[model samples]
Target chain A: MKRIALLGMPNTGKSTFFNRLTGASARIGNWPGITVDLLSARILLGADMVEVVDLPGFYDLHGFSEDEQVVRQFLQNNPIDLLCLIINATQIDQQLPLALQLRRLGLPTVAILNMADEAEQMGIRFDAAVLTAGLDSPVCFVSAKYGHGFSEARETLRQVLERNPPTNAAIQHTEFAADEALLAEAEKLVARSVSMPRVLEHGLTERIDRIVLHPILGIPLFFLALFFLFQAVYTLGGPLQDGMTWLLTTVHDQVLAHLQPILPGWLYGLLVEGVYDGLGTVASFVPIIVLFFLGMALIEDSGYLSRIAFLMDALMAKLGLDGRGFVMLMMGFGCNVPALLGTRVMRSRSLRLLTMLIIPFSLCSARLQVFVFLTTALFSSTQAPVVLFALYVVSFLTAFGTALLFKNRLPSREPLLIELPPYRLPTFKQVILRGWHEVHHFLSRASRFIIMGVVAIWLLTHLPPGVAVGGPQSLAGIFGSWLEPLLRPIGIDQQMAVVLLFGFVAKEIVLGAMAVIYGLEGDALSHLMAQRMDWVQAFSFMLFILIYTPCLSTVATLRSESKSLVFTGVSIVWSLGLAWVISFAFYQSARLLGY
Target chain B: MSMVRLSELAIGQQGIIGDMDAEGQFRQRLQSLGFRIGKEVRLIRQALFGGPLQVRVGSVNVMLRRCDAASIQIWAER
Candidate 1:
């Protein structure tokens, strides 16, 4: 298919425009030099099916940044049919030189001034004819966020595609002596075509930034902002997850339970417990991931995400991650699944991988369920919260430990250079669409491993068909028994080892597995749990749960997001090793102290 | 023009960028990011413990480490 590459500077709403044009049809493709996947979608534009690929946004065509290299490499390597150059209307004076350079390339090009709505509000106006005439290409205004002038931009792109301008080596050879004059030409063009007030005052943004980026209050305010956001998630994710669970259970009891007689026993078990349960586990995460992405998109689109980077860069830099990596880590506290998915905000491959490696160390809410139970069982009323708080401190320390370990190894080439765009109110459409896209993204990309991993665990517990589920004779129980010798030193007895197997599938089921192991529920389960393992043993086990590898869905997400089996394996191995060492030290030390 | 490193400018101070000493990609990056020779530049704020400086050139604000900022030679207006 003929290809159109969308090129622009960062924060120009280019990706938003790409999403507007393509909807959810976008597919990710890995290129050789670039670290992140470039999204391309095939769409029919004026009866011609063309692939639109969104290139990494950068400052200059002549620059040597990684993003610039990707843009230059793509042009040199591929036979692009058209170039759709997006420019922010508000920043046209600074952005136009890149446009002038590309226009000089004589490729089939169309320029669109995106964020026209914001520009108009800021008293930035344009003479359409002058801009079009000066650029010697079709220049259209669009607010990609609000769908304003979208069809017009699309039609202009179609018209440019129809003209069939030279798709030549002009882009590959932009090294003319007169290349420096492009800026002058751009200035001349802007002078004729654009008009704006002499002193621009974004009063609201300034006022908001005064607090949001304050020297003393900034960091605390960020946490406060996040606290409120997750408060929304806590309020919303619970009921939505419960509703989802109710719907899935109703399907199981009403739909699958009836099929038990018609289907073979093996088939019935596979469908009812394996596939159905696998899907249920994956579906349960949808509400939280969607809610997270909504709040994340709001924070990002409103430009506060960069502020976070700005505020946290100094501290995060000490750990070898920048401000953006800190954002992903903070998100990991809610759930490692979406947080792993959230690493897309970082452009550098090393930075993304390093951030991802540490994110799993973040003790998420799933592990929280196990901790809450363990703390309540062992520690008294005052002690539970303290123990929980201690676990959180350890979580952060481990995250830092891993980051400090890997920062030098990966060697992040992308420094903390970031553009702090003026904050704007996030539009409802953008937030909703982002949330939907993330959920869809999770379902499509990570759900496969989630289902497969869950099914595999189901097999481990259900196999040797004659044995009862999770019985001593089953695969999971057998494996746990086999590992008991290795685990005993860490205070995780055989039964606890078996429960860890279940916890590996998901920490949510850790408590349930304990109940199943003792054949008890509610207070009875806690009672039996306490009788079997004292505080030291329980503490050791909870440590293992806290520091071990991420759950099945998270593992799937790590695999899909990193796109490297080796790195995912390394992450799993690193966390497992850390969990073992920590648990062992605590258990052995407690014994040494004669606890 | 009497020029000094951009990092030498105090917080809230203004300057006209004179020349940048960095070569190859870094120089080009700084220029293209609107730190050209005559652009009016202002140091908005510095992060704590000698962190990145929030430097505004034209209407765009970019955060960069002080080490990188030191390469940009600018005429101080403070």
Candidate 2:
């Protein structure tokens, strides 16, 4: 299939446009699912089969953000047959540099002036014929949200294909030199077709910016926004989450009853307990995670996310991290995997590495299961969200504090510089598509990893090799014994110690180990531990989790991204040291206080 | 004063980028993105909380944390 790449700046509705062209199924298989990997979908353009690849939205080809690199690689490697370059019409001047470079690359490029409705609202006007004539290529006027000019763009692509276009002979991989010509061409085109005659010189961006950027009140307002975000994640998300859990388990029970008559015990257990229950635990939180992602997606889509970055830039600089660093930190809450993947957005290599080093400190959504499960079991439902929120606060502090120390101790760096896109409403189709893609990814991992994890824990807890009278001689016991000394400072016993040991392999496995140790009710282990260990031990456990070694895949990715064994090793050591010191401090202080 | 830090400057305050004193990998990055001297810049947006400030230079909207903003020196617009 001929690959068609969708290219644009962040918040230009690139994904929205991709969904309009290729539909949800294409995007699910491609970029939205993994968040790290670029995804492709096949489209039938009349008789020709075209592969539409939705690339990460980025500013210019010059930056080092992972998404930008994705674009750069596609350009350099000549992966796609055609480039569908989407530009937000409102920010044409700012976003045009990348367009200029793509034209110089001599790719069969079509420019779709997206968000035309928003542009019209702002009283901006453009002549498409003039734009097309100026760029020397077909330009289509599209509002991806409203589905305008989409078919025309596809037709234009078909026509471009029919021409039997010569493989862009001018497309040589050289920097600045090649871009110089493209920039000149774009400047000429903008001068002819696009006109912005200082319309409303002092607009909303300027008016609202004063108080928002004001030294005294700005920080407090930002905190309130974050407080509301966390509150919404729980208060709004709770009932929906409870309803989803009931629905999934109800289905699981019905399926078990239907199969029980024909199937044997092991077979039934394997299907219902091993696969259904385990995967259900991971999938049960989909509603809350989806809601959380939806809120984030909307903010990002509306261009408000950049404003948040703009607002936080100063605070981050105070903490010794830059503005771009906030993106990686926010992404960490989604999943540490992609958060680490997102470090590529940092313009500097050290900042990228620094962000990566601190990412694990940001509490991922998947780990919320462990936190909520532990807190609710030990305390009340009302106290659960607060406790969990506190842990998140601790995690945030850990990231900031570590970044500060690293900045002061490691080396000082330049201030941040980033492009800020204007805010716009994200489409439902796009939100659902992106959410579905991410949900599918979590399910895929659960199917593959959760099954193996359950089976392994089952074997470790059961069998001829199992412990006699359940007193630490089983397979899990042997592993726990090896890990006991290491975890003793954190006040964990052999059993809890083993869970921590397996936590390194995959975080979800920590849940699996708990299930095995405490039976169907994970609360049994939590309640028992709550009696022996006070609040300090719990805090210590949270700290260790925050700063300890990342799961295996993260380590591998760090190696690949950093391309240095030494850097990876340093990350592992520093994380371990930080965890140890924090946990040790908490444990010692607790003992000193007679807790 | 020679140059006030970019983050400390009020919105609409214009200045020339004086120095970017960041180090390590990010230092190399600052060099690559044309954040060099003589570029005209102004603060445009600030977040509600003591967050990053959005600044404009030429045609670009660059967001920097207040702290990083402090690292950048700028002369007031004449």
Q: Each candidate: what lDDT? A: 0.77, 0.69
Native contacts matched by each model? 0.58, 0.61
Per-residue error (Å), model 1, residue A413: 7.8
* DockQ of all candidate complexes: 0.33, 0.28
Worst 10 residues of 1 chain A by lDDT: A168-177
Per-candidate TM-score against the hidden true structure: 0.60, 0.62
Write down the TM-score for model 2. 0.62
- On residues A1-595, what C-alpha lDDT tens digit does candidate 2 reach at each position? 5667788876677767886887644422423222334545788998988878776667777665545655665555545567889999989878777788778767678888999888989999988787787776788888998998888888998887667543532235677345546666877999999753222233555555566556677667767777787788778877887777678767856766688778986567556655566566656566777777766665556555666566566667676666667767887777788878877766557777777778878787667666765676666777777788788888888888878877765454654556564434456787777777776776676557667776666666554442552247777777778878788877777777766766777676666556655444223445765775666777677668767875777788889988989889987888888888888888888888898
Top candidate, metric DockQ: 1
**DockQ score for candidate 2:** 0.28
Indicate the worst ten consecutive residues by lDDT in candidate 2 chain A: A27-36
What local lDDT does model 2 show for residue A150? Answer: 83
Candidate 2 regions with alpha-carbon error over 4 angstroms: A1-202, A248-271, A465-471, A521-536, B1-54, B57-60, B64-78
